[model samples]
Every structure is written in C-alpha cells, then in structure tokens.
Target: MIRINRRILAQGALALALAATGFAAAADTLKDIQARKKLLVAIDLSVPPFGMTDAAMQPQGSDVDVARALAKDMGVEMEIVQVSGPNRIPFLMTNKADIVISSFSVTPERAKVVLFSAPYSVNQLVVGAPKGVAIAKMDDLVGKRIAVVRGNLQDLELTKSAPKGATLVRYEDDATANTALIAGQVDAIATPSTTVQTLASRNPAKNLEIKFVVKVQPLAIGMRKSEVELAKWINGWVEKNAANGELNKIYSKWMGLQLPDMKKLADEARAIAL
Candidate 1:
C-alpha cells in the first residue's frame, strides 16, 4: 500500500487533473486516449440501421457496434452523442467528439473538409413506394413528389441525379419523411437501402416496398482534417477488426442479412487503410 508504481501513479494523477480542470481535454483524440477513459463518439440519432437510438432508447446499430468494439480494443469506453448531419463535422471541429461514428458518406468534397476513416460499410440509395405508387423508375416521377431527408447523403445524391420533373420534398428526419410519404404528401421516399428496410419492417405500410436503383456509397468515420496521427490509428484499428471478421458479425446483427458478394470491397478497403 505504501509503495506505488510511479507510472500508474502518474496516470491516475493525470486523470484526476484532467477531470478537475479539463486542461488535457483540449488535446487531440490520442491525448484523450491517455487521459480520458472513454472515446467520445458522435452519431446521427435520427437514422436507423446505421447509427441511432433503438426502441430501448439506447445507442445501437452497425456503426454504434463498431465504435464500441474499437473503443474496447483501445482500452476505453464510448460516450455516444446523438447528433445530426450538419452538426457532425462542426462538433468534431469544436473538440466535442473524438470521432464521428455516424454513417457519413466519403466524398471528394467532404474529404477536403475532414479526414475519413477507411470505409467499413457500403450502402446504396433506394426508392421506396407505398402500395399504390407506380413509380417503376426515376423517369416515372414526372411531376411527382419525393420525400427526402434534408442535410443527408441521400439528399445530396438526389440533387445530383434529380429526375426531370420530380419535386424534391425535404423533411427534417426519416420519421417525418416516411410519415409524409404515407400521408400522400410525397409519392415516394428517396433514401438508403438500410433505412428503407428498417422503415418497412418496423412500421409496415400497406404494400410498402423498397428497391435499390442508384449507385452505392461508402460509409466511413470522420475526424478533423489535422488529426493525421489519430486517423492513422483508427484506420489500422478498423482494418484489423475487419480482417478479424468482427465487422461482419456487427453487420449481420443490424442489417439482418449478408451483403451480396461485396467481400472484395471490404477486403480492398482494409488494404487501403490510410
């Protein structure tokens, strides 16, 4: 009791000091690793089958599982913050998050603004129609209303490939978008395959159907642009877990099925962990 290991004492002291003054808290995620016992992970709370609170009001889904596993491997816990799309990057910029574990799409425009972790998952945009809508293709939406969540990757994707005569009706969140579609405000909802699947399964609408008709997008973790060291560490961490097959288990749990022969994309992503 009288003799204490100096390094252990130092770590304990540092933890106490950081908790008291939050001085060490200003340091980057790596420093947060040495000082804080938990990793602060940001996620989108409105979307499902990715990152969001479940029916029990607890953070859950694919990205949430990955974050938890990564933090555990790093000898830390995870503090999940429910955030929105517009607020994610800004939150990281303000040091409110160690990393964004949200299903953020990696794009050239976005990559310039923040560092992206290796893609852990890929998802495709889909068209969802309730029982009576006969929207067989993008061209079928002439003068039709489509529900889309504002400030999301789907919205960006829709804007890029907007149909000739479709009206893009934006909503604040998925629940709103789905509701609007059900209420005849929108003929269909444009979203990712996973969200459309979750919506149809959880709250079934009459003859609801989800179909994939667009390019798939890669989902990655986000961090500040300058966090090269931590980003490197995260890339390694993700790759290692993926190689070990942990990501597959998590994917199956949340997504409810095996992705159709996309193991090559996952393997290539691991090889390019940078």
Candidate 2:
C-alpha cells in the first residue's frame, strides 16, 4: 500500500510539472509587461544608433526608439538601464532587467545562455587605420598595434584572431580607442562598423574611417531563457514594427540605414533552435 501511494504521488507531481511547463510555454509576455506598467530594459549609454545618451543626457537612439515603441504598444512605461556588454545578460537573468535593447549580436553560444529575439538590425565590425595605412584584409593587420574596447565583442573577436605579432591594446570606451589611434598609441582601431562610423562622423578624419573587411553581426534583443514569454512578446513587437516600417524610420534617423532583412537569419536561427 505504501509503495502504491508513493508511486501515485510521484506520478501526480510529474503531471503537475508538465502542466506548468505547458502553460509557461504559451504565456503572453505582453500581459506581464502590461501588469508591471513599466518594463525594465538594459542598454549601453555609449553605443550610438543602438543606445546612447543625448545632449540633454536623455536616452535617445535606435535601441531607445525600439523599446519605447514596444512599450507604447504594450501600454506600459519604460525603465532605461545603463549597461555594459559584459554584464548585460547577467542582468537579465538576475531580474536586474526584463529585456536588453543594446546592440547585441546573436550567436550560437549566446543563444544557449539566453533567449534572443529575431535580428532587428545588422552591425558590421570595421577597421580604422591612420591615413596612408588602410587595411585591405585581415592579413594587413599583422604586426599592427590594434586598439579595442575591453568587455565588448570586438575585444573577444580580436583576442580570438589577433594578427600575428600584433599587440592588442584595450580601453574602456570608444573615445579612448579613438584617442589612442590619433595619438599614435595604436596603429589601428577596430570596432562595430556602424559605431566607428558614428565616431568618424563627429571628427570627420580620413584616418578614422570604418573598413568593411570584416563580416556583420546581426543585432538582437536578449531575455532570460526562463523569460521565453518576454522573447515572444519582443518578437511580436518587432514584427509589428517592421511590418509598419517604424523600425526603418528609427534606423534611418539614428543608425542611418534601413532595417536588415532578417528572414533568412531568422530561419537559420530556427534550424538551430534550442
């Protein structure tokens, strides 16, 4: 009799677990967002077009625009969080943030850690060298002192494929990297192509141009895997915005480009879905 009761209890527990998971899988993230009346979002204040503080020190950029539009659609307010690349995902998992609107690249390794929305934009990493020393390929970087921002994807990629004999110098921000390049501290600077383009716009230096030798990274929003509902909500929001061209308008106004065609990328992600 005891063994039978124990087995029954175990079966009941398993049934409840499956039922909960079934409900969780289809939960509407929008409903939770609306109930909160405000959604917490993380973004870097430094990266332009994606996220940045304006002259008035207000959050205003592509990331901000997208978040605001989504919040508006959900009928909620937004809580802008300033974050760095290193800790962005941690913040989401720890409930420090509900969503990440930073210029986040979607990678297989990253997807394993968290849920990612469809690609909303494309960001290419570019090389910037002093005048008379333009780099035509990755091979040209050999022996060149490279400057990069620490705690960023650029830093990771540079370390992974550093040119033979090249010395990698890392800084905390783009300003420092640009300054290092101008001061002759490093022979070249590498960063997201669009980010470098934004910096180049401010200084207008022939030496600070973004090179397209490297491939582009498709940018996406991030959420905790446990927050799959949030991911779907963001996906729906992106679909709605893209279908209406609001995403394009925001991209043109901030990043100075059209939204990337993410259908292929999305399908590819589906093939590798966790």
Candidate 3:
C-alpha cells in the first residue's frame, strides 16, 4: 500500500490554488482595475515610518501615501488590506491583493516569483552592538551571538554572511530582537537602520550603535509575474511621481530624512530591456 505525505499534498494543493488565481488575473491587471474602479493594495500597518495606523485607525505612513498616490493616478479608489512580512508575497500570489506597497524589497529570489517595479525607496540593514562590543565589520561577528527578526531580509542577509562560529537567534519581530539585545540575551542585533535609530532615540543611554551594514535593500512595489500591463502602468506612475519630487516629499515627511539619489524606474526598465 502506498501512503501519501500530507504535508507535500497540502503544499501541492496550495500551489494549484495560487496558480489558478494567477491565471485568473492574467496579463491585463490594469484593465481589470479600471473595470472594478478600485485598486487593492496590501500594506503592513504595524511598521512605522513605512506603514502604520494613525490614531484614527487609518493606514498612515510613507507606503500608505505612495499607495494612495498610485490609486489617485489611476483615477480609482484605494482599498488597503493589511498584511505581515511573511504573508505579503502569498497575498499577491493568491490574487488577494493587486499590489504590495508595504516596504517590499526587491531580491532575486522574490523577483523570480513576482515582478518588481523600480525601487521606490531604499533602507539598510545594519548590525548594532552595545558601546563596548568592539565590532567594526562583518568578520567581527564571528564568535558573537546576534539577534535578528525572523523572516526579514536582514535575517536572510545575516544568515548568509555570518561566520560559522557566530550564533544567530531570530526573534518574531524587530521589537523582540531589540529587547533581547537590550537585555544582553544577544551580543548584537541585525535590523533596519530605522529600527536601530528609533531604539536609540527612545533610550539614549542604551548606547546601541550601528557597527556595520548587513545589506542595502531597494524597496519596490510587487505584483503577480503575469501582470505585465499593470507593472508597466505602475512603473510609469512611479517614474512620474519620482520626477515631480512628490515621492521625495512623502519620504521626507515620514522618515525625517531626504530621499537619496538612486537608479530610477526607467533605469531599471532599461536594464531589463538590455
């Protein structure tokens, strides 16, 4: 008698379902959006400076502003669906969201599954340690215990480059990682620059300082791989907003820093063409 692996079967079923959703979405997502007259965006309402809920419980942040701007450019109403980091890609793959604007960083692995428009913003994953830890570079992580937020790009990056002797403990989120570092549960933490900055701002005496950069992530909007038309339209919108300095204004308003110069959407498009 043959036995089935329930886990494998379940995964297969989910893959089929997601593929069906993708097929239904097809290549003309822009047309569908126009017909429906509403753009569905998946955003994380928990991460601040990028996405969060205001006192009125409405999504308010840089990502939220960008989403609103995109919807306005499309001449459609905006509908936001809150999501966490782990589930954002799944939501897009399953056709539950038309696009993801929740600080979605562009990576080769993710690019294989979904299309990314030009980078909308950029952030760095940095290693932070207590004042006397004496860390200066990636090599210094050897023999140290580092904390990182599970399933985040920083975790992936640190996992890849961390020396074999280093111990990496992953917590559920940035808050947990920061807590562990503060309590001396870990020698250091790998997290976004924003997170570390906020931590330092809140507790000036903690003496947590950035040691080195783990990775520099270029964040972009995400859509189904099949949605070429929608990607093109969104890319165009991003280019226009960026050129008009609207995106810089939004970033400065939320992040308290001026947007840095980087490759624009058109440059990315040109690279793809080449």
lDDT of each: 0.70, 0.69, 0.75
- Candidate 3 Cα misplacement greater than 4 A, ranges: 1-27, 55-57, 182-184, 264-274
Runs of candidate 2 exceeding 4 Å displacement: 1-32, 173-175, 268-274
Cα lDDT of model 1 by residue, 1-274, tens digit: 0111222211222133223333323346676675778889988877788877757888778888888888888788888877766567667666778788887777655554567877777777888887577877777876777887665666666666666667677676676887786677777888878877777787675567874476566677887766777888888987776777777788888887654333566444444343
TM-scores, all candidates, are 0.82, 0.81, 0.82
Q: How many residue pairs in model 3 have overlapping backbones? A: 0
lDDT of 3 by residue, 51-143 (tens): 877688877889999999899989999999878766777788877889999877776556656788887777777998878998999889878
Displacement of residue 68 (Cα, Å) in model 3 is 1.5
Q: What is the Cα-based lDDT of residue 266 in candidate 1?
A: 47
- Model 3: how far is 56 from its true place, Å? 4.6
| TM-score, model 3 to reference | 0.82
Better of 2 and 3 by lDDT: 3
Q: Output the worst ten-in-a-row residue range by lDDT, candidate 2.
A: 1-10
Q: In model 1, what lDDT does residue 265 have?
A: 66
